[model samples]
Target: MTEDRKKGNSSKWRPQTMMVRGGLTRSEHGETSEALFLNSGFVYDSPEEQSARMAGDKPGYIYSRYANPTVRMFEERLAQIEGAEDCRATASGMAAIHTMLVAPIKPGDRIIAQRQLFSSCLWILKNLMPKMGVEVTWLDGSDLGQWEDATRKPCRFALIETPSNPLLDAVDIRAVADLVHNAGGELIVDNVFASPILQRPIELGADWVVYSTTKHMDGQGRTLGGAILGKTSKIVDELQQYYRHTGPSMSPFNAWVVLKGLETMDLRVRRMSDNARVIADRLATNPKIKAVRYPGRSDHPHHNTHASQMPEGGGSMLAFSLKGGGDAAFAMLNRLGLIDISNNLGDAKSLITHPATTTHRTLTEHERAAIGLDDTWVRLSVGLEDPEDVAEDVEQALAGR
Candidate 1:
């Protein structure tokens, strides 16, 4: 480990310690694993106690929609892992994104966001926000100048996704946060790519951090969930109203699954990131590969920034373009036997997807091209497989193509 990494707060204990024991809450039984509460609402022992709980005079869960022990355990554990003052779990990542964005801005407000995003996220910003009377401006996310320019205008919110989907683009979270703060706006970072294991946007000065727990947190394809973390004031007082009333709360069973997923997340992410580094290096030397983008690799545009921001490594995700285009990509995908042809990331098994037709299909051809998602672009989510096998499978697939 680097000297800086060896001496930080997290340096004292390895990531595994943080992942397993960071936010454990045991009941009187002292169970080894986090408990699951499946009930929709908690019953009171007495009418007076129930009234007091309802009036916020006592501290206990009144309804599952508002809170549950399992959901609270997941939230608390994630908050501790993220080093945030508060957190709330949503039914899915998009639900977390929607609640965070829609809850804060009023009609006639303005939001500045990065242009490259998940297709669903792009639709939320470009299509949904305008309809709600919130004007939005799209800027090249990596361009600090464009961020400054956009923030200088009257903006209430800013949305960014570091190591963006499909393209693996990155933005300086601290610099952008500074600019957003100077212009009187809150910066929300979608940290799904880096996962909490690789990046902590709140420590970088972002006002809020969101995650698609469906990805790395689960480290498997078993469940779908999302979370938002920030200071206690906005999370409890402001964001809670929108989250609870919208009824997008995470199910207790899903929360229990995610809770278990967290125990080994750090290990899974580390191994996956290592695999990504190896694959990225091998892919870069291939003649059929047009370009490769992995934050861990030095060839990436923001390698230095990613190095400073992500202490563990770039992450388990990377994207590359083929020399022969979309047809070539399909041929390679068809021949691949080890890696699954799926868009989901942060799984125990390797997966691949073509962004042009799958994730970014919502965009027009011109818009998709503008974001560097060409027909040949293939996104790979490295898993806990042997690096040699992964590399050989990719090479064999490309050869058949």
Candidate 2:
């Protein structure tokens, strides 16, 4: 470790402090901000140095596809905040998910996953994994009994997304982790919805944690990035080979952008959660709304589990079903003059999406119904806007119903 790393590790700085200063390595110039090394290749002092680096005898970046200084800085900073031994940054959220799922397992391995997940993730499990000769079993994430029953037969891995996409369903991470462990399987938690500011899955018994840094980390909706955090052995030893060869590496520029965004992640996530809570509460009272789901709210189906696992807040996302179904949902979205219609979440600007038609469109009607995602459901990603103003905009949109 360098002197800067030693200092950062020795000091017991809090999350906010670490976000600003953790894993920061200065160039010889001593610049105030993290330097972006945009070069695709690095120069070596001699052929001996290049041979040593290639042979793993020396420590230096050989190629951008394998590693880069700016990307390393972002990875280290994220690992510090996440309390992980190491981390790897990816090109996008889906890339991170694909890497985590495909790296450790082989043909005939069994993987269990929560049925309620982002459509892309669902496709990987239900469609892609099988082609690779991997068997997948989908179960209700909120049900501890189902998780236990499913894990009775040992599986290679298990995956789940807490505060599930569009629906905001919370899963019991600790219990599920314990079950998966006893079954001799690793647990991977997709924590994009919860954000690192509110949830740390590694501390809750998850063997690995994944995030779409594109979301809350880059709260400005600027860059697309993803991260995987776990033991150094798992990341550097096991996953690095696949990552290096497959080339899903994050760009140096995107890494730098996300590094800057991490500085304000803690503040922005909390503010957005606060705004989401206000909007969810207001929407619950509207007669045109049939149902509302926000983990921060006490009435949520798994509110107790959410409280125990995610004590920080409900997160910046929420979902509700309109009484009039798809047409009314589109009408309400069209009527909104403030909130933009978008499929992306965790932005500085509030975004709303109709999941049945957009994010989860690939699923058949029966599959959609099985997950309780109907035409009326609308997913909202609350932003850093004033809570009252966001509430008013949502309320006025409902008036059009």
Candidate 3:
């Protein structure tokens, strides 16, 4: 802004302002919108310069596999909004998440993670990582006691999701971060559900914060991308090797799409979050719903921690159980007209999903029970619709349409 330019530092700009303008790299023509560098390679000005750039003695793009102007703009803008020292984009949200867990890990290194995570994340921790000769342990993230107990032993990495997927469970980030740090481990937070507009894990002492930019960062559901942000070498320098070699780089085109998404993310998330608050209240009073968990409500078991941890109130995600069980949940989802029944969340359109049958299906009945996910439970990602309309559709569905 003209005022900000006079103030002399972009860092002083607020979150919404940063999201729109932070990572801009104007081309020679200085287009009003960001330019998409769609090519996979850049031409060298000279062989000497190419050799210098290739050898890392200079700063310029060598290959699109690791770096692109459009992707870098998205990374920088998000980093500024999130207050992260640096950021890197990836192919998908899961790519960012899986990479965050595996990037700093190796054989024989132990990792501790919360049990309530997206199924893909669970696979990495419970299935894939163990097969790689790494020891993995799971804990109830809401239980600080469980966190402390698990981190008391020396471990290389600790992973958790605040307001975890579908369930909305929250934990004290600072308390867990200190414990992990004391044990010579790093705390990596997946702050996907609670977008940077609502939470900044880095400010809460997290060593690294990761995002599935596919979700709220690209609030319109236009693209798939992921990012890892931190102020440490582990993310800036070390993780670069893993990202470069694994070929999980994000598309420069998707990055540009997300750049447009970021410009309006502040408005979209806040509106959706507001809609969620209203829908949660309506669901709580419904006779057909057995239980409701929303971070903004005082009745939520972890509402206090959520309030302390997230500067904004509860986000757009909420979970509820039907008094009529899975059949009723499925029927209700089938009846909805305005809301979509999909595995995806964080979209301009409202979405509903039965966690047991979809996102967590890989977990056995026994494993699902262990995590408090049951057949009747449904997860809702509130959207940019009228709150009354969303609530009415849910009510009519619960009432058998």
Candidate 4:
């Protein structure tokens, strides 16, 4: 282990400073940028040294599947910014979610989650967990009564994503964390929407926090990555074994790319969030739009909760419903010239997607309707583009409708 990792000096610095210089360790050659240790394995000075490392008597890299210097730098930098004691990087956001849920659970354990989740997450809880003999329960995330009632019985774990996907519904993290803990369950918060720059779930009492670093962390629609953050014991002891054996490891190159991306994440997220607020406000007034959902907006159903938890900004995402349903939604999307029609979000370019068709297409109409996803609803991931330009493009599209 490097002294830099041990000391974690970045923790004392502010978030922007940490992103730029945190977890920085230089090789003997003293490179300015973080070195990418691309090799699959490392060498030991002697067989005795290798034995000690394998036996846990000494700390050093063994295999890329387990750890690498470049990946560790990324993990440490993110952990510092998140205020987590430790962090582990994975191949993708889904991989991080899978590891966090699967590592500390066993067959027949009970898991409770909010119903409004990303499509892949819904699949895992609804389909995969049951096949693994894990009991899963779903509830409306914004309803505290539902959370309190369901957690009355003991459970192994509980998970929720605040400002939920597509809808931007907010949940009380502190309240949920208390309920889950009282029921002998650990709380795992998916903080992708409210990035570390916006919200820190650990400070709100969540036991574990996970992110698809592919989103705001990369902030450029480049390289895929995910991360899990929590106490050192939980990661090094409970989750590390499963992570190593399953080989859902992040590539050194991707880690390095994201490490560089972190340097500008704070600036990009703030600017993008400002742009989203401007666009969402404009959408709210348009007669053609039925509703606009932005956590920063006062009319949002959970605006108070969002204000309390993420006062920094409402986040760079917004969703609105058009009066014309799917056809009108598609027409507006086709008419927009400046924004790209891509499902991917948190990019430098504004992108939009129809949740009912693109992201949640697999779900039955009944299932989609239950979560407030309709053909007319469109989710927009505001990017670091000029707010006026994005608004102009949207206005022209809506004018045609």
Candidate 5:
């Protein structure tokens, strides 16, 4: 079955079927769902076999850190969906990003990244990587010219996120991939905001993709996990050593949860994205809204690029700011009886957060201004709720007594 799948000869099976049944390795019990293996290490039948496995002369799981049956199923299933040859699950999303960047580059390496990213991700580039003697540069991702200009000097890596967090802004993946590749750099995309259901960065020319499975993949917010997917050689050869030694492995239980989450991810993401589109439209026409940004809208800065990149409607996240100010925004958040105030996204429950105060709060006020995160700005993660209820909550919240 694995051989057939790798060759793309699976008889045109739909994505939903692949999600449910792909990468199954049943034991003697013949379980319908994938079974969990909770042991720290696998035993070899003979001492010689163990030695061969240790020397990379055999094929099988050795230690949980390097590989586990449960984690392998999740990684293979994710790789299948993303159309990548290999994948590795990490302890968290930042670990995946850090491992991928740090494994390949040495001292004096340079990385060019988009200015807008999750605050922790920004810290990795601006603060963490620089401490290791790597040079990091930030550019406006929406402008292809800026990307081109930045890469002209040659860099080791280029990273970006599309329909970026909090802002819902976009960077053209394929175009930037070309720019990075022409300069001999690897392109890595953080595809957390647009889950695999809504986007496939690999097909669009990304050399690798990363996900915070804790977000949309788990869908219910049950567990914390992350994954890195890319070409097989990169994973097994380059990243495998770094991953095994550093020990940021995903737990078997979390992998099992991620596998189950994959089954319903498509349905949840579609409905939530639809609700988000409706909410974005309704809020755009209101008198209290200074600006509304949803990639699904025709007026969005990158509507044309989005049309070419994402044929589906804009994803399940959007951001808006009140014309009145932070006080008004707080009143709206306070009035919310339906949407929960939280930092997490892509949960079963609708969530909203003031990025300036919560997610991006660590950045200075001037830095927040640079990224369009103001006290008045609120990022909404639309969930599997009736569109009317979500919109009504926003409507009432905007009106102050």
Candidate 6:
């Protein structure tokens, strides 16, 4: 451990140092593990102290809905890793995204975003906000022309998801951020696909970064949580305000789970990403696969862009199309004995899912087609299993094909 860690000076600690030691508060019992404060409320010495707590004169937590010790530890530790000034943990990924995206723009404000995003995020920008009178101009992220055309005027927020779900479409954050900045908009990035270990969007010029902590942060598929992180007053003025009053707080138990999860996130993400790079390479050469979309692969269209953004490796998720289309895809998915068929990604167990049915099913056929998503596509989240074991299972699934 570094001297910064020894001193508990979070600002001076490195990412790995921050992950292991940041935000740790020990009880009088001197337990090494973070104490889980499971109560709904806190007690004070006197009415004056209670009033002070409620008045924000005191720095302690009043209600679990607004904050909790365990959850704050989780937030502080993540903020340290992510290089953010503040972080707010929420009930789930959707809550983090919704709070970050919805809080800034009122009915008359506008949003410019890519068409390629997690289905639920798309719903917020495409379906939910439109009814409330917010205008969202969807664009193709890969094409700088669309971004240029859309950001010619001012908008409240410009959003992108790098190494986008299922497809792994990596967009240029700095490039888009420059354009958005010129137009006076804050850039919001969904950093879940490329966890903080792989990419820090705030450093890439994103004003706000969001995550489904249930994914890589939890690492074990054991809990539901989300976080929104930012380095500016905007986090306090806009996002935190929405977070506090709306009561989408993360549970202390879940926070404790993720706190433990964070201790090893650096290890798990790197291992899973390594496993994925190997598996993506193995699957790419298979004649049964029509195409492969892993950032580690040289042929991936976004390889260069993704490489710049995610310095560690191509992340653990990959998507490939079956040569025989949907039927062959289903056969391969069903035949895989080791990998489970599930929509969730970023778990310790390798998971495969048909996005056209499970994740992106909400997208209209036209929408899916526009993003080049077809029935043949299957998304894979490589896990921490032995590479050979995982590869053998995948190859066996493709044997007859």
TM-score of each: 0.95, 0.98, 0.96, 0.97, 0.96, 0.97
Lowest summed lDDT window (length 10), candidate 1: 3-12
Stretches off by above 4 angstroms in model 3 are 1-9
TM-score of 1: 0.95
The number of the candidate with the highest TM-score is: 2
Pairs that collide in candidate 1 are none
Cα-based lDDT at residue 48, candidate 1 = 100
Q: Model 6, range 120-219, lDDT digits (tens) per residue?
A: 9998988889987999999988889999999998998988888898799988999999999999998999989889999988888888899999999998
Clashes of 5: 0
**lDDT of each residue in 1-401, candidate 4, tens digit only:** 65655444544577788988888877888787788888889999999999999888999988899899999999988888889999999999999999998887889899999988888988889888998899998899999999999999999989899889989999999999999999999999999988998988999999999989899988888899999999998888789999999998999989999999888999999999999999999889999999999999999999999999999899999999999888999999999999999888888899999999888887899888888888999999999889989988988998994
Clashes of 4: 0
Query: Which residue pairs does candidate 4 place in steric collision?
Result: none
lDDT of each: 0.88, 0.91, 0.87, 0.90, 0.87, 0.88
Superposition error at 89 for model 4 (Å) = 0.2
Report the CA-based lDDT of candidate 1 relative to the real structure.
0.88
Candidate 1: segments with Cα more than 4 A from true spot: 1-15
lDDT per residue as tens, model 3, 125-163:
888898888998888989988987897789998889999
| Residue 294 displacement in candidate 2 (angstroms) | 0.4
Candidate 1 per-residue lDDT, tens place, 43-106, comes to 8999999999999999999999889988887887788788888899999999999999988779
Model 6, global lDDT: 0.88
Clash counts for all predictions: 0, 0, 0, 0, 0, 0
lDDT of predicted model 3: 0.87
